[model samples]
Target: MTRPGFSAVSVLGVCLLFTLSGCSGTPAPAPTTGSASATATATATASPSPTAPTSQAVTPSPTATAPPSSAPPSSAPAGPTETATPTAEPTFTGFPEQTGPLTIYYVAIGDNGVSGPMIGCGDSIVATTTAPVRFTDQVGPSLGTLLVNKSRDVGLSGLVNVLYQSNLTYVGGELVGSTINIYLSGQFMLGGVCDIPRAKAQLEYTAMAASGATSAQVFVDGRPIDEVLSLK
Candidate 1:
């Protein structure tokens, strides 16, 4: 009986002490655990790329330039040309020597084959053979009279086609009354006519001066005659 009564009192006292100790020793509950978080960061680097190779352009060569001219480049000189002096046209420096144009006065007295003659050319007073010169009213009863002067008497005038051409004419002469006249045509030597003889002329006369005068004597190259000559 005694033992049971003491245990109840002790058990009550021990319970009250345990309650006070627990209140004092307990720590504040860990702050609500903050939401756990972990963040990761990444960094990147860049490098430059190499450039491609390029090709170069080609150049042209220079050419030589020519001199300016009206025509073109040349080695010839420009100016008056040197011409050979036209050889002094083979001159006639002395007697009987002929060069440029020439004219001569001739007389035939030394040669004997020439004498009085009556003659005429178409529309021109030519010469007179050994016959009286026929006169007419239109021709005024007289063909021109002859003179003894050289170049003053009747000169040979006719077409070169019918007379002198490509030749030299040498003439002999004499007097007729108070007149001088040529009986023969010429003393010409032409390359074309040399081989051929000279042409002869016809003589027609009827005393135009004194009637019944001596029938004039005709002559050629100095040969006296009383007839007309035909030249062919």
Candidate 2:
């Protein structure tokens, strides 16, 4: 029954090839180990491990402070104070004593010619005296002598005592510094206008010469001699 050019030997050879193929086991699948390792690496990169929460340290800010003062303390004690003193003033004394024959001035007539002709009327001269005198004791006595009337009887010719009729008597005298104060108590009488000058000159000049004073003033009845003598 081989028909048509096909032979039994060809058919047997084909069958033998198929049988050999069946006896060998199936081939192993391709390895996936590399793919699995790649997948695990990707997962690890995508999901990072949770990191522990970090703690922060806190630094406090610096506090402000006040500066100290340069002045001294108020509790200390104070120092002492000083005071001043004042000065004083000066005083006065008296004059020296003198003694000798005294000179007395009296009013004279015609001594000054027409300018002052009558004695005691602005005319005068030093009268003569034989009696020695002490200057200290003569001030009262000298003024007393001028009160005597009648100059011709005392050898003083042309000299007039205008105060003889006034009844003025010499009191005590005081020598103060260079001045002599002669006190008199009396009634003041002048025979006429000419008698006034004669009275003043006789009293004042006698007082000065007797006391050796630079000036003299007469006081009568506790008043100035000029006031009393000014009577009309």
Candidate 3:
């Protein structure tokens, strides 16, 4: 039973077990090289996140620029900038009284440069009035209305109702034989003889009657009245 061959067999079995254990040792975890590769991949993923931040940073730039673009459109509505033209004089000059047996005849606007009827007002001068009536005096304080009222018997309307102030003034007169030169300053009315030839006829007749002149030459602002008015 105690054979010497038994110890030799036990020793052979022990050597076979040691060889199998060495072979199944998990190959030293493959030198842990795959873990290092996984870690590198994770680092690459983190690097790509930095690119995402760059993209995110650029997104805000467009948002900030959007407000500026919209702001210019808001200012576009401020367009209709125009200045108003002045149509009135600052201060009008004073009017003087009528001088020496002078008569001012008012001609209402009508057809053919002379209306249906004419109004001639004569005032006897105890002391000679100032030559040439002033704009203020001519249209002063309802004077035009009173003048219009005097011509009511002739069935004339809208003669004295000048809606706008006629920045007009009568200066001195120059008499050349039967032809008397009448001078006026500034504009008389918006219309002229061309528009209302009757009005011109009225004025001419009145001037001739007042100066006792056979003919009258009209001058406005030192220019011929014909030039200012489109006389027909």
Q: Which is the leading candidate under lDDT?
A: 2
Q: What TM-score, over all chains together, does every model reach?
A: 0.17, 0.48, 0.34
Error of 1 at 184 (Å): 3.9
Off by over 4 Å in 2: 1-100, 113-122, 133-136, 148-156
lDDT of 3 by residue, 1-232 (tens): 8665657779999999999999987765454788989988999988865433344444344434443332235545556657999888778454456434333333343322343343222211111122344342332222232223323233333343221334555565666999977776767554432333433444455566555578877777888877776544
User: Which ranges in model 3 have alpha carbons more than 4 Å from their true place?
Assistant: 1-102, 108-165, 191-196
Q: lDDT per prediction?
A: 0.33, 0.69, 0.49
Model 1: worst 10 consecutive residues (lDDT sum): 101-110
Better of 1 and 3 by lDDT: 3
Best by TM-score: 2
Error of 3 at 12 (Å): 99
Error of 2 at 144 (Å): 2.5
Higher-TM-score candidate of 1 and 3: 3
